[model samples]
Target: MSTTLILLILCSVMLSSIAQIVLKTGMSNPGVLNAVQSGVAMQMITTISTNLYVIGGLTLYFASAAVWLLVLARVDVSFAYPFVGLGFVVTMLLAFFINGEVLSTAKVIGTLCIALGVAIMAQG
Candidate 1:
């Protein structure tokens, strides 16, 4: 693959990772959603208006989509899909800092596996 293609894949992966973190942050706040008994229409409006996290998530999602489109223009889907795994590593790392989430030994092992897989795929 060309350098440009690799860079584009990496950019898309980073943007996707950032978007996941932003969305998680937005959802972590209280008052994000009410019980379903709150009436569907009222709940829908409140869900849209009050939930900043959903808004932020959608924005990041769209941004990621744009980056993915650009990446697809330059590389095959098989090559690009492996890079999405980077988002998992990024999200796990972000969770530690943002939400005080702990990484278990298994998770660390899994993440290492993912990194190795991506590295091998990139070499192909």
Candidate 2:
């Protein structure tokens, strides 16, 4: 792959990963969703609309989708889709460190398998 293609794919993955982290962070605030439970869905919408992190995350998600579309146009979907697995790895690591989530043995093995699968697919 060309350096440009590599960068584009990286951007898509990183943007997606970052978006997940940002959304998670935004939702971490207390009462972020309590309004829904209280039957006041409008409050939930208001909270989401006012949350900068959530808004930023959504923007990044759209950016990722744009790059992902370019990637799809340049390569076979089957060949490129495995790369999406990289996002899973990125998200899991971020979740472990940023969210203080446990890094279970199964998760590590699963992520490794995803990497291996991507590599195997790319080699074909």
What digit string (tens of lDDT, one per residue) describes model 2 on residues 1-124? 7778868887899999999999888877666756556667789899877888889899999999999999988978887788889999999999998889999999999999998888898786
Collision count of model 1: 0
* Candidate 2 overall lDDT versus native: 0.87
Question: Which lDDT values do the candidates have, in the order given?
Answer: 0.79, 0.87
- What TM-score would every model get versus the actual structure? 0.85, 0.91
Q: Model 2, which residues run further than 4 Å from truth?
A: none
Worst 10 residues of 1 by lDDT: 30-39
What is candidate 1's CA lDDT for residue 20? 81
Separately for all candidates shown, the number of backbone clashes (residues 3 or more apart, or on different chains) is 0, 0
**Best candidate (score: lDDT):** 2
Alpha-carbon shift of residue 73 in model 1 (angstroms): 1.2
